[model samples]
Target: MDYQFKLLRQSRQNLLRFTEQFTLEELNEVPEGFNNNIIWHMGHILVTQQLLCYKNAGVPCRISDEIINQFRKGTKPEALVPEEEVTFIRKRLTQTPSLLEEDFRNGLFGEYNEISTSFGNTISNIEEAVVFNNIHEGMHFGYLLALRRALTKTV
Candidate 1:
């Protein structure tokens, strides 16, 4: 559990780096062949973590439903995300893992409903959900990387 938490923090650190490295325009730019941009990926990662861990555990999510609707699975960027919202999402990108770690330590998640992920794994508990969330985040982080590369190529 300690290592899982540690890996999650480190992985989020990488995501935070991406957030800092891009401007609002760069983050919002959807490169060719990509359906979404860096900002959407960041938002999606935040929403996905809350949904998989808190919502699936029957606990109230720390984030709002509007965020989940905008960035959850199968969604794409419909309009430019403004600077203020980008800042909010960037703050969440750094803060969420720590808050989640604290919540898990406090046993906020006592039970989790089993969910079959699009990646094909069934998560049955908070620990599994945390672990799987990292896998999901990693996949999106990879997308973030590819999106960055594509955006830079087009520049």
Candidate 2:
């Protein structure tokens, strides 16, 4: 497996563990002023991989636009996601790392337009984006962990 893809797989597992015990109310809470929830963070990571890895390469995203928009960067869940949908989203996210593995093994980047990342750096290649995504995923995972702590009194 490619280094980036492997890291992504590890990240996904960590996220799954973080959310595994949370309730719908916990996943839906906005925490007063915060604009994010556990569910949103989970979906965001998946959508980002799809966009940066697949859509940017001219491939169609396996997930829907509505789901992406609801969980994309800076998007907060305005309504609770159906439990079934959340389950499906998790499964979908689990598939992304392998998709990345295939793309990296082929050594094909296709055409990715340059885009400014949250770090104020521009990434124009698929490899760079993949690396960036891994880092960002970690950051969000940390947030998810923190959210888990905040939502659970026993934590």
Candidate 3:
């Protein structure tokens, strides 16, 4: 397994477990002034997995175009996705890491295009993007924690 993939899996599992503590209402709550709900964040992470791996690897995504469009890099959270769909999304999240590994092994990786975000600098390879996304996901994990607090009125 690639070290980057391992990190992504670890973070992803942590995110899922963290999410499990919340009720559906809590997961769906946007919290005043926030851009998205917990469900959106979770979906976004999965969407990012494809964008950073399969799409960048020069292979088409195995997930649906509608999902890709909804969760892609810049998509916002205001879009309404049902709670049931969100729950199903969590299950689907389990399947992406292996697909990423497949892309890596099949030499499906393509040259990195520049990603302009808080991370800064142009990435020249998929490995760097993989590493960067770990940090990116962590940042969102922080948001998830905040959302949990906001929705549940708990610390």
Query: Better model by lDDT, 1 or 3?
Result: 1
Q: Per-residue lDDT for 1-155 in model 2, tens only? A: 36677788988987887687888777778665466888888899999988887777776777899888878877777888888988888898888788777766776567887888778888787888889889888988888777766666543
Off by over 4 Å in 2: 153-155
For each candidate, the alpha-carbon lDDT, in order, equals 0.90, 0.81, 0.77
TM-score (all chains, Cα) for each model: 0.96, 0.90, 0.86
Could you give me the TM-score of model 3 versus the true structure? 0.86
Candidate 3 stretches greater than 4 Å from native:
none
Task: Rank by lDDT, highest first.
Answer: 1, 2, 3
After superposition, candidate 1 runs with Cα above 4 Å error: none
In candidate 1, how many Å is residue 29 off? Answer: 0.8
Clashing pairs in 1: none
Best TM-score among the predictions, by candidate number: 1
For candidate 1, which ten residues in a row score worst on lDDT?
A: 14-23
